[model samples]
Target: FKLSLLQIAEVQTQTYLEWKEVHPPQLPKDAVPVFDKKSKQTLYVARLEDCTPCFYDSAKKSCSVSTFHGEFNLGHTVQNRKISFLLNKDNFEIFEWKKSSFGEVPPLPVETCNGYFIARNDFGLGYITDNSLITIGAKKQDTTENEVLTLNHDIKGQHLTITEYQIGSAKASENIAELKHFTASNKNCEAAKQQVKLDQGIDKTVSFLKTRTHTFGGTGETSVSGKVPLIISIGGKLGLKYDYSRLNSKTTSTVEKSLHSVSMEVQVPANHACSIVINSNTFTADVPFTGQLTRVYNNGEARRTLTDGIYSHQEVAEIQALVNPCTPLVDKKRC
Candidate 1:
């Protein structure tokens, strides 16, 4: 009986993350304001911790996402199954939510709050594989509705997320490792799960927005992916990866960012459900959504210079679409 969504993503990526598995297009129309174009994709990631790709299970929550692997479903319900955070932030109090503790969730506290760090604890968004500096967002749901989730990461990694569904807090204890104390209701969602756990020391990749699931009955099927870790270019090594040995100084201490695009709008209120899948596009849920999805990977215009370093390239770069995501955002914008 309550669903409010406002997704704003402005990621202008230039480049990383090449682990692929895409397939999400089931539209009967519950919500769709998609804007697609600028197609030229090429991905190929071979190793992300011995190939785990993406898979999550926090007592079986569902909100969809695939990258590196595991945990992040703040929506689903038949009876016992729920999880959520984020209580306020009407525009940069920094987008509210950050009060502390439920089972420990942390990542992104300060990196300018642009956000980009996706892996660890399998629920902490730790590594953020780096797909040419990616940022993708689009959220809309309905299984009835009642969802709430929020994420913000920084340690200089940049990862801000929000998926508002409902239920804000309370109820999600059917063995989520035994609910470390998340039953008392909202404390800024326990401070947004403790800032998603200290902003990534990173363990396995798990952390999200939407909670309610015992077995994805709400259908927000997720395996959370977008690994993309396979970039090698050397010639003098001032560190590694992309360096004709530095012809003009961009430094390179693991430089990745620039080419951003993120737009997330998730809301649930009624029954409850959640789901979010990027790099593979999938936001299908029965219900459970809060709202918030901010992805900003900035390193500055696709950092890769080789004026003469002998040159080398080729892995993935094939997608010449006119506009696809369903392509709808016309008239005033043209998609």
Candidate 2:
């Protein structure tokens, strides 16, 4: 019931494990360096492992991460429950059907609607697109364009929202942190380094995972009212061990899940206008010379649901985040 059909959660463990065996992920060759306003002198990430320099710090025989605040869902919108997920397991199946469906189904190729819109990615769990800017769940029930959301926000629910946010706020460094000694790990390419706790808040996440047993609601009836971890891991494998329990109850049960993700960054070339268009809106900003942005995931859980033939049960787990970058390095060329 965990990864149910409607869940549409990305199942990349097997695929990533296979890919890692062939060419295990490397720390990003270069970390977009930054100038730390608090320190005056630029705080550059100078760590690496497995012959690759991490986006944060993986070399210098140590692991370091930069922490920042970012979120996925604003806790104000509701995601639509997809009926298509019930019939397909992965995107490949969906793609196969679309390729031969004779135009009956719209083929979702990264961008759609002649570039008018794109899929909404919620970390790596799932994504969606709608005809409206406010999305389906944000509108009042009586509105003319009101549409249905998931079971959590159908007609029965009231004043509900899907809130995914870190409890703090931060300004991204005006400059990117440089990746020094990129080739330093080459000579000692025996094993990857382990995680180091500097400013990164990994200990906080681990503490929450172990001590907290009651499942908190993530979307409806949930708010960011507790201490949240600002640091996260990326471009690395996460050995996620979560507890599955009934909502608002003390009873629990479950196992561990390992997720593999490639580190990713998006940067705008200098002197060229860079902008991103989403739906009907456009965003323009002044990015520094080191304009690379490393993707980050939250360090909390979700209120994902499970169902038997007769009833559905609600559960919660952590999510993805951005920045305060810290990641683990394992053997077999993993970092």
Candidate 3:
């Protein structure tokens, strides 16, 4: 049997009694009326909400709202058999509901949660609290594939956890590999510039290094383990904020092989605006003023400022080229 637009609401004990008093029992078509065992009165069932019809169960002696299209009984709960429904056929499919060992309803599918998500490949973790989400561990999936596996755990009966995994897509894997290569190239460039600085002891070498190594969309990769838990927190009225940290990464291209660290902090006010500050130091080269940049976004417009104020017009143009490589300096108004 098939039913459309099914909605369920719990009945309060008092409300049920009042409803029983007002509308007495009546025999449904092709079905006999069932009387309450205690009251010995015929029980009446009425459509409380918008639906098709109601059904009287002879054995249970209860009337429940239901719809019928064929021989199957629609919108009625049955023992040992789970009920499922779907709206807008393309988006979802009907699935059976499962209960935990304690007879409680299991957590709903993770896709049903509405919020921003950050994942690496298919597996990721996240924490949600009051309009804010703190994503830790690996990144989350960014595709439409249904092969994701998510494990949820309740910690000490106080917190909710979500862990997701899926087969990595080809494009995603290629992107990750490309990022690693770009990081290696950037490392080599930074090392060459630092050697020039040490050998010549001149600021001119720094200028040349900054210009030659300036590349947009080529940031290095941070080594992150998938075992780290993803924390998600939601439900608040305050502004949104994010803090990301990755430690214990080393350069893959250099002989010295010093540690590489990256951290990012972002703030978005409740008024729907964003401000960001990024700081990093790699290979002992002061590329872009020791790797620091600040930006503010409002109403789809962006304004960026350099933290270190020691650069000529040509140098500023070089930095601006890295920031917005496609837009020429002559056309840019804010930098």
The C-alpha local distance difference test score for the whole of candidate 2 amounts to: 0.19
User: Candidate 3's C-alpha lDDT?
Assistant: 0.20
Q: Could you tell which candidate, 2 or 3, scores higher by lDDT? A: 3
* Tens-digit per-residue lDDT, 170-193, candidate 2: 212111222111111211334333
Estimate, for each residue in 246-269, the C-alpha lDDT of model 1 and write its tens digit: 111111112222232233333322
Better of 2 and 3 by TM-score: 3
lDDT of 3 by residue, 142-259 (tens): 2222121122211111100112222121011000011110110111211121110011111211110111111111122222111211111111112212212222111111111122
What local distance difference test score does each model get?
A: 0.20, 0.19, 0.20
Maximum-TM-score candidate: 3
Give the lowest summed-lDDT range of ten residues in model 1: 1-10
TM-scores of all predicted structures: 0.14, 0.13, 0.15
- Could you tell me the lDDT of residue 239 within candidate 3? 20
> Which candidate would rank higher by TM-score, 1 or 3?
3
What is the Å distance of residue 70 in model 2 from its true position?
A: 44
